[model samples]
Target: MSVYQGRFEGRCAIVTGGASGLGKAAAARIVAEGGKVVLWDLNADALAAAKAETGATDVVALDVSDQAAVAAAAKASEAALGKVDILICSAGITGATAPVHEYPLDSWKRVVDINLNGLFYCCREVVPLLLANGYGRIVNVASVAGKEGNPNASAYSATKAGVIGLTKSLGKELAEKGVIANALTPATFESPILAQLPKSQVDYMRSKIPMGRLGEISESAAMVCFMASEECSFTTASTFDTSGGRTTF
Candidate 1:
């Protein structure tokens, strides 16, 4: 029997980027705990694979950056999951690592579009559904890079910073309601997302961690499960540190 077998007995969650990485980890944990999940991703094959692996209730192949697509998916998610009691916004990309002036304009925009704007769109469309239900948990996956800016990753850092800001504002706005919003700042973890960065940049991040090693996927998923639970009642707008002593703030 699962340790969290009954923690989410009747809950349903929407996990963006659910095909892999932190998102997939979170989805797996939720399902293990008895919650239903809807996997959302841009890759149809990944979505199918994730659905098969996790027994997710549904899958939506979507680009969260596209407002219309996000809106449509939100409706579909509601239909599939019945009600989205939890939302884990784990869809993001580490764009090209470059200094501010050296960063490509297109790449910078793309990073902002996916990491920041996509999150905004997902929240924008889903928050109302959550509010109508009168209860919701929102876990936005940020990075330690946002808190302590990395040397050559301007766009990624900026977008994650935006996520933190957005979470704080959303939490305050919904404090009186039954909805809660928060962000998670995690250090480099062993996941597919790590392959997007250069080895030099990856090594640089690992060196910065006081733990002397990269984070594990389970560590992140554990924190996400807690934040997505009713146990996280008093922590809206707060930032959870999963950064292995890398985040001091």
Candidate 2:
């Protein structure tokens, strides 16, 4: 039996960026544990593919940076899946790899919009539904860069750092309300997003990590699954690091 055996048997979960990478892995695990999943992604093709692959009926194409779109997506998810018992905010972008002063303003804004604002929109819209049901679990995907800022990636690092702060604040606010919120900081992972970075940047990232290798999607998914389960009831407003010894704090 799975750790989430009967925990989320009939429950519903929402996973942003679920079309691929960490989000898709989490959605797959949720379904394997007997939970229904509503996958939200900006990529329609990827969304369709993920739906077909996971056999998940609930899929939505919407930019998480758009607050109104996020609201609509959440409503649609509730209508499709009944109620959202778990939420995994994982949508993000690598942004431009350049010095802070040399970084393009547009690129920086876009990264922050997707990584930080997108998360805020999802949490803001989903929390109400959870509060109404009197139960909820949230796992926000952050990064090791958030804890220790990475050079040449100011936008990505800053936005992830903001996610950490937001998770902490929300966790505390809902601590007594039966809704738990937490953040996961994973080091460099072998994700599709990594392809966006240049080889030099990738090398720099790997060199800094003590693990000497990128993390696996399944490894990150396991941590997310645990956090979204009822077994993680007591912990809230905390950062769970899965950096393969790279995270020292």
Candidate 3:
């Protein structure tokens, strides 16, 4: 929230799930900070609207869960932005709200496919490009649920945990390559993703937050932009918290 004027100047980024919520918020901020972004999301209509709203350089519509689609998107993104200096993988879903004993098999797979494998695809594709440039930043959006598993939301929690692990491993691999990768672990936040959960589940998450309120988009966006900026020079493979006291470690 402090003065980050032109912090991202001349940078080009690829933001997945850029159609709504925190992803869209981060895109707008990146543009405000003098950077260009190519937005990617599954919804074509939403992608178009977000592109207009965020001043994004271009938009790609494809399901992140599809490996082929993700690879193609990365190529298209590179062509659109000329080069990618940053990648923000924020596409995910909170699948069925059922206990592990009763969870829907298909729903669980869907969540993992998008939240974990999809993100992996994006990182794997873009990392080479980042190494080629000799400098890059990656912010993988995870969740506190990953650290403190949520009951009845095993799939979501598990996938986010996988995201954290992938980011850590990636950070270490690229630490000497000038390409840094980190994960963002936000608590219960006011995101459209919440719509996927039931009210009881939402309230349960809110109660666990010491602040007794959901996180703000601006709050998380600030942390996100910081992690994706040159200011995050010394940190990689670490988890940045924006949980309003929910995560004290």
Q: TM-score of predicted model 1?
A: 0.98
Runs in model 2 deviating more than 4 A are 1-4
Worst 10 residues of 3 by lDDT: 1-10
lDDT of 3 at 123: 94
lDDT of 1 by residue, 123-236 (tens): 999999999999999999999989999989999999999999999999999999999899999999999988889999999999999999999988989999999999999989
Q: Tens digits of per-residue lDDT for model 3 on 158-229?
A: 999999999999999999999989999999899899898899999999999998899999899999999999
Stretches of candidate 1 exceeding 4 Å from the true structure? none
The TM-scores of all predictions, comma-separated, are 0.98, 0.97, 0.98
How accurate locally, in lDDT, is each candidate? 0.93, 0.92, 0.94
lDDT of 3: 0.94
lDDT of 1 at 130: 96
- Give me the runs in candidate 3 sitting further than 4 Å from their true place: 1-3
Q: Which rank order by lDDT, best down to worst?
A: 3, 1, 2
Model 2, position 17: C-alpha lDDT score: 96
